[model samples]
Target chain A: MTNAQGADKPLVLVVDDYQDAREMYAEYLEFSGFRVAQAQNGAEALEKAFALLPDVILMDLSLPIIDGWEATRRLKSDERTRAIPVVALTGHAMAGQATGDQQVSCDAFVIKPCLPDALVAEVRRVLAARKASAAR
Target chain B: MPSTAPLTPPAAPGSEARTESEPLSADRERALLWRLVDAVTDPCFFTGLEGRLLIANASARQLFVADEASNAGRRRAVELNQRLLDTALASLATGGASAVRRRDLSLVDPVEGTDLLFELVSTPVQEPGCTPGVVCVLRNMTDLGRATRALGESYRRLRASEQQARSERLRLDLILDSVADPILLTDPAGGTVLMNDPAERLFAAPHDSGEATRRRARTNDAHLSSFLSHLLSPGNARRWRGELPLVEPGTGAPMPMEAVASKVLSDQGETISIVTLLHDRTEALEKARLLEQLRAASNKLEAKVHAATAELAEQNEKLRRQAFQLEQASAAKSQFLANMSHEFRTPLNAILGYTNMLLQGVSGEMTPQQRRNLQRIDSNGRHLLQVINEILDITRIEAGRMPLNAADFELPELLQEVMAEMDPIVARTKLAVHTALAPQLPPVHGDRQKVKQIVLNLLSNALKFTHEGSVQVSADSAPATSTVSISVKDTGIGIAAEHLEKIFEDFQQVDSSPTRAYGGTGLGLSICRRLATMMGGSVAVQSTPGQGSTFTLHLPRRMRQA
Candidate 1:
């Protein structure tokens, strides 16, 4: 959803299981002059991620139907949605770090109850990294 | 013809004398016969063919004493002599020329009063153209008969003894052969005098060749010589027994033997020979060796079992320690997460976030009442942050993750700063605040920030508990110790005796009832206790119901330099 300055704004996708957290993040991102889309679960997030094709995806790790880990894997595996930078939001700060023999594949990780500004900053940083790698 | 007149007429007798009418040769023969008959010790007599007694020798005259004196007066005697003469004459008649008759007779001797046994012989004497006569002789035989009887008894006893000796010898031979052990009897010269069947079989020649037989003989000779020498030696025991290793004469193989050797002694105490008894010990020795091997194996197994049991015990101890450590780590992790999650932080984040957005006019301008409500949310969010910070501090202390920032700091000055910062809280309560500091109070050592936090926590707890009385803060150097103690005392609602100890535990308060009106995260006193303990110090509380509570923070005067 966008305000009056819609066409010029960069689009952002926000996904979270908690409605209050999702609304807060989406409100903040929209207020910061960005078009935003929201999905309450990972499945809906994946559908909209492909349908909307937003510039960045803010994904909560814990979701209903499909978890953020599998959704992210699917998104990265699909050639059409592979370019979208996905930032993992989790209650566990070290969720994106490798555990045992498993390597968590994510562009960025943000701890839960994070500052809105910090989350926004992490999204921009991952988008820039994606662009740099794509340019290469 | 010249004839010898009767030199002595018939001295006694029923005999008649005849005139000398024989030839000179015949007269000489008659004279010789008369001399021979007179010299004999046996009784002898000559009688005429007509049954008259011609002549008798002296022994006969003595036998017929009654007839010697009176021939015609003793008619009974004459008759008895006549009967004897008749017997003699009858023998002459039966054998016309030469007849001999013999009889055994028992007679009682009148002189000796003893019975006499005699043999009588009658011989006929006849000459051509001469009257024939019979001569009788008596021979005694008592001594000869007694000698024969004695001799027969001796012979019978000798025969019986000989039979007994033969039987005993046979019995000894049977016993020797029946024994399984080899036995040998040797002479003093080391020659084999006798051996049992077992010994002979044991030492039998190999049946191979003369060479083998010769070899066996040599071995036996050597063994016998050794046995005899040892037995006869002066220093050797009379009976010697021991294990002997011998080479088998036949097989020429080594064999173990149990041997006993003893000297045989004669009745005169002379050494007659030596006897050696031997048993083959090959099987017994094999059995002993096997038993030793089994015992060694059993000992090794026992040692292995002991080592395994010790190793198992050590492993169990190690596992138990590791499990305990893992449980401790897990508990620490849970406490850390609980402290971090607090949940107040998450909500505060949203409350503050939304409130800031509203205040900053992110959506649009807000009404006045809305602004005030937003400000109240901001204040409460900040209060929750403080409580969250307290929780974090305690978690760090308990986790041993909090680092000390030690430096020298003035105690009075620090306390003054703490009281000044507490001015707002203190202003809200109707309680008075006081501070007491020693005149020469020393600057304490240890974590400066943590010490500041400890003082702030204590002061706040005092203010929060006391409603109508003054709260006193005091600092002094503990006597006889290298420590500084800061104490906070309040006179508000006094802690119950039971709650005094509970106040310093995490999430515990004197009055934990939600509606009882004291507001706190209940972590202040616990954090103070933990922080003090981390600084090598401790906190103590003293309280009485209806009186008030005093909490003391004791810190080391000089922190350890790292």
Candidate 2:
């Protein structure tokens, strides 16, 4: 989490294999008035999500361990992290496929080479969709 | 008298006659008879009632010759002749006067020493007052005995032959009946001369009224012809082979038969009768039927094998095509890996993001010089991103994989969006931007995103090349050609005539000097031209060095797929 972040602020977990890309996104989200935690792989991401109880997860599909899709699935299946939204951020097109007609683990898709601002916007949109669905 | 003499019977009128005229006729008759008897082949003799010799023929003398050593034989012969007379007299005493006495006699010739046989005939004479005692003769009979023996031998042979012929006939009948198939011997008129047991059963008449009802078979016209007429025909061969059907006795289904008919001919070559042999063909027909069914089943199995082989061939072809597609996909995968890695857009994204954060004072406060340097880094990173994007775009287009999103869009509206997108560059540089869109420019059918990218390329080129003059964006429709042209006019350093064509090639610029004022990868014009060509359009340029340039893109009103 960023220093000086308030308890009222929402938490976001950023997962990526690329360290610089993960840190940059975290830095921008921290600046954008959200507490941001980081993980370099999907295994670390799951650990961070469960410990921090983050409001949302930014997942990169290709990872060194436990892959984003499987990590997201495990997170969704657990009661502790079921409510948290997952946004897939990747350079590759359509890396995560939904199993038949099931609701996908990733709540949003953002093509990479994405600017920090666009990534923030997509994260906000996924969070907002979750909020609306929860309100219903 | 000689051997030919016929002196008459001892009881003849020569003994009974009393008239003198009778004696002359009788004597003359006696002489003629004696001459006839002398000409006979048999030994004839006549004896008087007194047992004296009346007459004798040559055969009698040869039978009882009186040669030098035969006087006793003559006396014995005389005694036998007189005894024959006495026997006739004795038979007359008991059997009345008309009866004759006869006996067989055997004697050996005294002269020839050969045996002889004679028949002795003795008769009583009664002509009122004729000669007394009896009249007799010894008739030579040796040749008669020889003839009788020959006749008896002939009768014995005839009887044996008849008995053998009867047995042969019976054997022939048994052989004909023993045969399984019906064998019939018939006359030319269809009259049955001989019918074996099987033939009799085959051609039996209908059961009589007192018997159980049953079918009795008769030959049809063709069968009759095959059995008789065919063999009877003079022009036909002596043998005939043909097929005929006789209805079964009870089932009435035809029992097929193979017939062989042969004509029995006489020595003169006339048809005597016909012999027909009828063979049952039921077993042969059943075998043939089974063989036919087996062949049909085998043929069906062969066809099934051929069909399975064809299906296997089709499956192999499908697998081959799948392998080829997999190879192509692998090539595409490698291409993507090389291009995406080389581009490194994520790093550029991070750099620009960090630089913007610093400029926004998120990292801390920065000096004006530091801000300026940071801005340069940001700009350079952005430029590199554009260069990478352009290279990737060209690569995709050359691979013929660039996807199009063709839709109707107003050219003036798209131009407004392009101008707005370039406002930052316009402000950064001191370039003036203006649009002179035709009042009634029609909406175009094209890939809206690609068309916008082409417009952006032209606008950015105009803005980048020009030093201080205004950049003009204009669009107009050519109604006759069904086209719309968007021209980007710039007051900038223009291309030479030789370099004009070269500028449209990939990574080509008017000037290659390192210190040139304008900076770019020089791929914008090439990309624009290719995009225009892909959309059924063209890009034309008119320029003069150090004065101005106008690059116009001509697009069709409707998209035409290549």
**lDDT (CA) for every model shown?**
0.74, 0.76
| Chain A only, candidate 2, TM-score | 0.89
Top-scoring candidate (lDDT): 2
lDDT of 1 by residue, A1-136 (tens): 5343566677888988878778888898887777899998989999999898888999888789999888888998899898888888875432334353223457777765576777777877887887799899
TM-score of the second chain, cand. 1: 0.45
Q: How good is the docking of model 2, by CAPRI class?
A: incorrect
| Tens-digit lDDT track of model 1 for B1-562 | 0111232223333234555895445555566566677788887766565645557765655454343444453445434544654664465466544467776655445344455556767776788996687677777665665677789888887888888888887888798889888888877666777888877755655466577655765675566556567777665667878766666665767767788888888997667887889888988889999999999999999999999999999999999999899879866775666546545556666777677677878879989999998889878877877776776666565555567878889998899899889898788888878999877888887888888888888788778767787999999996578889889998967787777778888898867888868888888888887778778888888887677878888888987632
lDDT of 1 at B266: 93
The C-alpha stretches of model 2 lying farther than 4 A from their native spots are A1-7, A46-53, A69-84, A92-107, A129-136, B1-343, B428-430, B513-517
Tell me the spans in candidate 1 whose CA falls farther than 4 Å from its real position: A1-136, B1-321, B324-347, B353-372, B496-499, B510-517
Which residue pairs of candidate 1 clash? none
Looking only at chain A, give the TM-score of model 1 against the true structure.
0.87
Q: What lDDT tens digits, residue by residue, belong to model 2 across residues B1-562? A: 1222333323244445456655467655765576677678666655555444556666555543344455775656644544544554455446644577667766655455465666767665557775554555567777797788788877887788888888888898999899888888888777888888877655664566222214425444346565567667577898988888775644467778888888888998888888889888887888889889899999999999899989888888888888888768855864774457444766777787778778878888999999999989988888887787787677667756677778889887898888888888788987778899888888899999988899899888888788888889999999999999999999998878888899899888877688876788888889999999999999999999898899999989998965
- How far residue B204's Cα lies from its native spot in candidate 2, in Å, is 97
Q: Pick the candidate with the highest DockQ.
A: 2
Find the 10 residues in a row with the least total lDDT in model 1 chain A.
Answer: A93-102
